[model samples]
Target: MSHVHRDRKKLLTRVRRIGGQVAALERALQGEADCSDVLVQIAAAKGAMQALMIEVLKGHLNEHVVAGKTEAVRAREAEAIMQLLGRYAR
Candidate 1:
């Protein structure tokens, strides 16, 4: 099975938490919360998103790159990861 499938439950839990953070951010904006409070919410949501991305990236590297059966397959996975990082970095 793929790493994503193996880690589905854990990933889903993180996603749900991120969703809650986003919802809180929305509510803060709607409620005209203090600027500092809104900023804190924004930071929390951003950190959660980054954490999720890192987890998935790590899994992809481990399963598809490090443990790949062939050098060609590993190279392909590395290129895909590089492409993803390029987009993400911008």
Candidate 2:
């Protein structure tokens, strides 16, 4: 099974927390929160998203790329991950 499937509960929990952060951010905006407070909310939501991405990326690398059965397969997986990272960076 895939790492994501294996860790579905844990990942879902993180996702839920991130969702809460986003909701809070929306509420802050609707309430006309101070600029600094809004900025902090945005930062919190962004950080949560980054953390989730990193966790998934790490799992993919460990399960799909590093543990691949063949060198060619591993190379392909690594290349795909690199491409994904490039797009994510932009």
lDDT of 2 by residue, 40-63 (tens): 999999999899999999999999
Task: Give candidate 2 misplaced runs (Cα > 4 Å).
Answer: none
Model 1 deviation from native, Cα RMSD in Å: 0.7
lDDT of prediction 2: 0.94
Clashing residue pairs in candidate 2 are none
What is the clash count for each candidate, in the order shown? 0, 0
TM-score of 1: 0.96
- Residue lDDT tens for model 1, 1-90: 998999999999999999999999999999979999999999999999999999999999999999999999999999999999999999
List the RMSD of every prediction in angstroms.
0.7, 0.7
